[model samples]
Target chain A: MIHIRRDVCGYCGACVSVCPRGALELIDAYLTVDETLCKSKCKICSTVCPLGAIELEEQ
Target chain B: MKEAYDVLVVGGGPGGALAAKAAAEQGLSVLLVEKRPAIGAPVRCAEGIGKEALAEFIEPDPKWIAADLDKAVLIGPDGTKFTIGNNHSGGKVGYVLDRKVFDRELVWQAAEAGAEIQVHARASAPIMIDGKVSGAVIHQHGKTYEVRAKVVIAADGVESKFAKWAGINTTVPLTELETCAQYIVNDIDIDERANLFYISYTDAPWGYIWVFPKGHRCANVGIGIAGTKSGEGHRAKDYLDRFVAREFPNGKITELIVGGVSVCKPLECTVADNLIIVGDAARLSDPITGGGIYNAMYTGKLAGEVAAAALKKGDTSKMALMVYDTTWREGPLGHALARNYAVKESFIKMDDAKFNSIIHSMSDLSLDEITVKSLVIAIFKANPWLALELPRLLMTL
Candidate 1:
């Protein structure tokens, strides 16, 4: 449902740290997601994101 | 004859209520006007607040609270990380308040102190005499009337147009204003004890994203950007969306509020003759956090006290009204506000790598140093750019 660009992510890790679903992580200097772990319960990280790099698709 | 009030507070927000409370307790007659039909309806905040700053004015009540928070996230422009750790600036540690109830409680408290309140009344301008501020003009239900008072307190909020009428300069430079927007969402699972602030350099450049959880299932998610940083093209809503689409592809925006936060220094003077400005009207908001509830109440209390004193002395002039502005700036909130503005400036300049390093690193530091300055300093240690920005902020602090 959510997409993060590895190239432009800049690896700030803010999204990784703040995700309530425990969905995001930092791997190789970019943001990664634990797709299996995410409940799609809520996505607070994308809303409060700083760089505007996030994109979402409907389930 | 119904006599004029001793203290007339324009606005029934936290500032107005507190102003009325402080004045009435001091034995001054007070009147509070609210433009809305209700005291605390249509809540607009992410609903988060530090607890200690709140104690400066009133005691904590669970009747107005939803949750406690103990963490912050600092992301960079490009998704880099910075972690500020956990800190308590306001008392009792944290909260995600039920603002509608919370605000009404404040008004009730003021009323208990003998302050009168009127809803749906919009204050227009100050009632002046011989070049000195006295009271204000109000319009309600298609009827206009002039209310006279010894002291008038303007708690009209940020972007308020009252100061011009009172003959005071209240312009907030574009650079000093932060355009903010938010969404209340359902089904967000978060630690009830920890709140989240997500920052990224390329993500928000001048603003950060916030997800203040109401409980294990609900959250108020939002982002805010410094005005003039990205120019007309920069929109808080757009940033919020882009971030959400990436992080919360499934979450939908349930409620939205577009507003602004001011990071500029407090107005040079908040008092003009018999008139005193509190809250956003006087720019008492937190620059780094963009939080104003606690600070607004703090300033409102001070404003009310000063208004009461002026009435008692029959000297509602500039000399008698200086009390409100001087007191708060010297208190704990004011001390933090100054440090926060400096942090706000440094924060806007960071990129993702620095933010990432700092935020990820925060997981290792003690949660106590999460003050705005401490977080910036930690990130500065990791990034030379931040280190370079520190000097200017440090000098000001």
Candidate 2:
């Protein structure tokens, strides 16, 4: 699973752009993750987040 | 809102606003939707744009002009400084903008041109009919509307969900994506007439730090790094914090903004059946500078013109829309993108020593015209070793 620290997130949508699965979306200023589509192994979003808001957690 | 329209534009940034305005002016019923509560708030841009490029779209307004820069200063990794006057650079480096007000002015113009505008409207999914984007499912104010349209312009920006939903591969590779963080800092002494850019491989790998003046004693201080270089303690914000602590210790942070820029090439094709993608959604930002304002507005206006013409001809297919892609690619904007991408690739691979050498070499040059080609030529004359190191960059020029 991907853990999003909303408090730290700037809602810049950098993670959403690099998500190959198209699993991340920035609705206004809130970031949402589609669990079913999100692949934990692909940590592209985690790496690209300028604020380090998204993290991959062990299921 | 009507159940159908001639054109539907997603997003409310400069791109979507211009698209709506252009299409609506052509007598097309256009609907422009923004997910945000207002047109432009919580701004995400560095807000610097060239004076002439901007004049092509709208006249200059004092309300939105933060500062009229007369020169640009480049600081190398080893602190070698090189200054380029605005006239020497062909007046390319110009105003720093107040995007919050600038974007609203654009949206206002669109509305005045008869484009129906709606805020708090989010497009959750593309209404695909047999794989063709007919419209979108817009969620607004706790309700969803299945809006239909003859043409859909996806100006949804770097997040760009609409294009991906409509089946365009809009993913920016980690190495190619520039992660940026910025702060609106006040009470700092600065040369307001000059935009300062600091290039340091150790500090901001594959990107640069900038201080664009907003007004006296205030500026947009920011840094960007390649997405692949960002991590837990080495994120764009981390580097930015370090720079701010050193440069502007007494500066007050009034606002903080972070975002991603696709420094890769534009989309392979910007159109599909009944669809057109413009602006950051199409990844048209400058590869070297990470600037997208002019590119977004340029493509937005072009897309609107193309969409309107196609609708009048009663053909909204991909074949008809390819003109939008072809026209931009063949024009000056496209040529600059290609050349700059090559320059960016070469520059990012260079070490601190190479950067210092290049800046040192150019510090004494007095070129009347300061284009990229002239700069490269000057560097070759001063440091012939660089040609051997980056022959590919020279080949592109």
The best candidate by TM-score is 2
Of all true interface contacts, what fraction is found in model 2?
A: 0.88
Output DockQ, candidate 1: 0.02
| Model 2 lDDT per residue over B73-141, tens place | 889998888877755564455899999999999999999999999999999999999989999999999
Note the clash tally of each candidate.
Answer: 45, 0
Model 2 CA lDDT for position B5: 98
Model 2: residues with Cα > 4 Å off, grouped in runs: B86-92, B367-374
Best by lDDT: 2
Residue pairs in collision within model 2 = none
Q: Each prediction's interface RMSD?
A: 17.4, 0.6
Candidate 2 CAPRI assessment class: high
What are the chain A TM-scores of the candidates, in order? 0.76, 0.95
The candidate that achieves the highest DockQ relative to the unseen native structure: 2
Residue B206, candidate 2: Cα error in Å is 1.0
What digit string (tens of lDDT, one per residue) describes model 2 on residues A1-59? 99999999999999999999999999988999999999789899999999999888888
